[model samples]
Target: MNVIKRATAPTPKFFKLLRNIGLSIAAAGGALMTAPAGLPHGLVTFANYLIVAGTILSAVSQITTLNDE
Candidate 1:
């Protein structure tokens, strides 16, 4: 399948949940990273990691497809 076809393909319910969770994690990380209040350096580093992990998770989940019978 082509990239566009694969990307638009139907995803399983469980993977859909994972994709949503990943998006939530990335949003939370973005908020934490950009908060006005002073945050610890370690936390900021963690936030960066969260963003990366979330992005990867979401991408992987999005690409998953159910087998055609």
Candidate 2:
């Protein structure tokens, strides 16, 4: 017996690009946060904010990308 796989729906390329960019930003933010030397209070706060925002954007983009049904 043979079975074939098929996609019931498809995602647009732009959504995939947006998702990848958001994830890359998240990686950059994480690297900044875990620096060997601690960052100043204000800069630390800003970096933390970027991490959070980037994570949220990544989640949203992934959801959009996977919303095909």
Candidate 3:
């Protein structure tokens, strides 16, 4: 029988997004540290942008449920 379960399942998307963002930030930070302070590029920038957009969309789509009395 199919039954409605918990609201949250294993958040693969979120975790993957977070991981990509974190790695990008780390790479960007490292680049800036050693490159005489300038704008970073490559995967770092792309990943950062994608991460922020994904997070915003995800949050926007979230729905809250009210308990029945």
Indicate which candidate wins on lDDT.
Answer: 1
* lDDT sort, best first: 1, 2, 3
Number of backbone collisions per candidate? 0, 0, 0
- Model 1 per-residue lDDT tens digits across residues 1-69: 776776799999999999999999999999999999999999999999999999999999998888897
Model 2 TM-score on a 0 to 1 scale: 0.70
lDDT of 3 by residue, 13-50 (tens): 55546645655655555554455545457745665665
lDDT of 1: 0.93
Candidate 3 stretches greater than 4 Å from native: 1-11, 36-69
* 2 versus 3: better TM-score goes to: 2
* Winner by lDDT between candidate 2 and candidate 1: 1
Q: Could you tell me which residue pairs clash in candidate 3?
A: none
Clash number for candidate 1:
0
Worst lDDT run of 10 residues, candidate 2, spans 1-10
- Runs in model 1 deviating more than 4 A are none
Pairs clashing within candidate 2: none
Q: Highest TM-score, which number?
A: 1
Model 2 Cα lDDT, one tens digit per residue, 1-69: 111112223345786687678787777878888998978888778778878877887666555534434
